[model samples]
Target: MTSTRLSVIDEIFLRTHRGYGVPIALQGVWRTTGTVSRDELVRIHDRLAVGKLGRRVGKPRIPGARLRWDLSPGSLPLECDTEAVENIVAWADAQADVPLDPQYGPGWRMTAARLAHGGTVVSLVCSHALADARGLIDAAAQSFSGSAVPEPISSPGSDAADALRMILTVLVRSIIATARLWVSARARAELRAFATSDSARTPPHRVRKMRSVVVDIDASQWDSAAEVAGGSANALFVSVVAATMAELGSPAVIVDIPFRTGSGDANSIGMATVNIRGDDSPAVVRAACKAAFAAPVGAPAGYPPEVVQLLPHRLAATLTSTPGRGEVLCSNIGEIPPALSTLGPHRSCGLATRAIHPAAIGPLPCATIRLSTYLSRMDGRYTLSLVSTDDALVESTEELTAAVHRALEKRNLAGTPW
Candidate 1:
């Protein structure tokens, strides 16, 4: 019965859903080392509704009309597939494209498939309206709900001053935003001209479909690579992306790194957005990641930045990129919750491989790389997914994956994890 107020940034996806065809769903894929059965799956679903794990409350009683989670049973569909792992993966991938409709009355979906290959694959598909890439993954963790409850601190008699400052900031930013709009066409033309030599600048072909390539790396080796880079495991993700883009011969690309709200509370999750330049060196990657890690969250309208999303989704996106924003979105959801037998009757050793199968409608930036890990770092391997609008960019995903491996291995930065 708890309803949360969403921020403008959170609504960016809402706008996108309303205007653009972008699939608003953020997807997380897990390969269970053990099989999950229908009965076991039922228990997990119940837990989700009861708020025993993950969601504070389940899906909204209804969708599209508003944002809410309905605790009713049979509300969330758990896709049951007794087929091969690929089948489960494919189904999970398609969940993002499930059109948003008021008739549906909610924006979340779930799938648990018992793999014929001796494991299980589970997916938590949610409307970007519910959470971002990182927030969505955190949503699957049992502890996510408890930590997500937000507490805002305020002082008495300070509202007036804060309100005035907000008014001024909004007025100034709005004016600038308006001016940019009038000249946006020219800006895009300039970008297009600059892109003539760099094919990566081109948006995906009218095929304007979304696609991803998940790259797996040994968990232990990944940790060592991070150590050598003098950064956390997440930094290594930034390094590979920056290195790949540099190899592509682009001058510079701004990587939008949206940091998740540690609590993963839906209301507070949309307030942070980080933009860092990507370049040729792992050192630069290390620096950018550090800055992002330290950057402060922004507020809009005396609240979280979700206000930015109030504008049309495409417009909201353009505001960031029209001038000189980087088109590549690279991020890593460091590690996900390990498999536990409590959630089911399976052996629950841990995950085999993980995939971030993000579903979107079209017109993607040059490219995107999303990384995630499952199980403990000791045995959890990283999953890297390359996303793009065009098939050409999709083709490069493999090359880039190979390139990162080569760079790490060649530097001897990648060694046994002890």
Candidate 2:
């Protein structure tokens, strides 16, 4: 018997056409309290790898044909010091001159980063355009026997938490479905704001420099809001961000909502990244999100082909709006496990995460707001990173944070992802 160099699914990565070259990095914070072992870490890596074990089709930007399905590499080190993590990210602002390899099935690369005191920071940066946010979290949960996996239709909420994970199988299926769905009238409607607006008709001004700042905020704010709004923590955070954009002058925004409904069908708890593009009206965006979560029970359908094929144009239009595009890009990676703190006994638990966008928006890209909550704690960490040549935006992280806080205070909760 010969050892399989790579799984059959892995070989398909080079053939995937959905711009599979995109890189997605998600960091898992595990406390060293119980003696974290390499075996445990590898197990987590393996589970996530298994989640991407399916066949492939056309070729994507990443090189190689035989290894295409997931294009994720096994966990590798981020190659920098604890303090360097911040610097490395800041440097990437001008250009992503950094080297990235997606041959791994999860495109899931790892960095066994060591903190100043002790312990390890396991970071997995995969592609967001390919995988959904929920799927990323599910991969982490499987490593530690987390409760949320997709199971049979035996019980309710099974869609979000059951564990039938034939990852690759569902991935290809979702892609095909999404492509087909996006190729219809719905896709046009979904992108109406971008396509119809005259302000979005022209090309955007060239970008001069791209600067980004990443900070960790407390999730307790989200928890309190979720409690009051009666919605999932993720939904509340997104609503808050949408509301903030509304106040900032852009009354329209597009948010990528991840879907994990396949889990209910005994499929792997993977994510289908969908655009719940809506006007930045706080009330409108909130109502849309709330409805998606409040749906009695049903997985959101994949985007059709029309939607997929026209996404670039839609994206370009959105970016072309106004003297400059919207001032905020908010992403809420809901409750990370408290164990994600990669520090030793001397350090308090902390989780570090980053979100990326395409490079088309000139030297300076989009401004981003990231929020993550923990199930065990009332607080959540909110990081605001803005990409721009604007001096005022670059200088004041506190101002952005304060604005976000106020937006959350007035968010309405009545929307749905569907």
Candidate 3:
């Protein structure tokens, strides 16, 4: 038997869910050429539930112990909208508002709607605490290929015994971490000045909603635009995002790029940071990206993972700082699996993936980072997904879509919005 524990990042996401009631879920939308029947939707949903997304986070038996995964079947049923909608993108965005519980079980949901014109829009929303973007994609690909679900991995010992061992290990690591912090002058200084400004805080009175826009560009045109801009596809993506943020009145742009670390953990992603300007050419952005890739990946927080995991959710939230105003997350999902292009007897014409907060209501928790962009290549086209959380900046979907078009025009590229 093998033991599986929650990673530091996963633990942080869990804290956010329990403390703030925010269901930060990853959503993937697929536009198929033909309508998917209810029976087919159920079939796909059952397959996904048996995959990696089937597990839930099991709380530690005692305080200061680690959290484990409870291998069990999901209970959330497939949600189907009987009403046919013309705008599939809008329908997909509405599905993000559905509640998903990561701790209890069924940390994911699959919804489908038929397009009035002629196709089907299917969306799968998985709790971030359960899986990241890549993990979700992998699970979908495996399910589509009719792969057999692996047997659940069991714990080596009792929960009490595991707790005892974890507590002892954490004690030793915490001592070492405390000693390092005491000796490092920079660490001491940072701790003394660890506080956010009032302006940086998310106002509780601000009524904000998450609005998303999907744009699809021809593969040949995207490639040609990237070549003309003197950068690779990823660099072009970053440039467009930076420009869009700049158009929204950002002074400086700091982009976080998540790279795969090959770890089998649910959220096995290492982040790299790069700084760029709205007017910077794609070549400049490309250079910055190249430099960031070469640099070492840093820890996500100031404190050690062992220490943070030991603290209560309220205290742990303070340790995990929110992204600043001009910060943007540019996740390039790269090429998607061909299996995902076909879902339940229909071929997908376009696909988009993004992270959404289902419980986004009165006071946004991490509202400083107003915009996030995701890129995925499928079916000879590049689908760019944009999620804007700041009502003050984006105001409306049309404004956000217009800004994107303007940014693309500067790069001599054009796209069709969904």
Task: Report how far off residue 189 is in candidate 2 (Å).
Answer: 8.6
Number of colliding residue pairs in each model: 17, 84, 0
Question: Candidate 3 on 75-118: residue-level lDDT in tens?
Answer: 67787788888987788888877667788866888888888888
lDDT of each: 0.46, 0.37, 0.76
Ranking by lDDT: 3, 1, 2
Model 3 Cα RMSD, Å?
Answer: 3.1
lDDT of 2 by residue, 147-260 (tens): 323221111222212113223345576677558566776645545543444444222333333444343445555455566665556555555555544554434454434333
TM-score of 3: 0.89
On a 0 to 1 TM-score scale, where does candidate 1 land against the true structure? 0.64
lDDT of 1 at 214: 48
**Candidate whose lDDT is highest:** 3
Q: Which is the winner by TM-score between candidate 2 and candidate 3?
A: 3
TM-score of each: 0.64, 0.49, 0.89
Please identify model 1 stretches exceeding 4 Å from their true place: 1-3, 50-76, 86-91, 100-104, 143-207, 246-252, 261-279, 291-324, 338-343, 347-380, 396-418
What's model 3's overall lDDT? 0.76
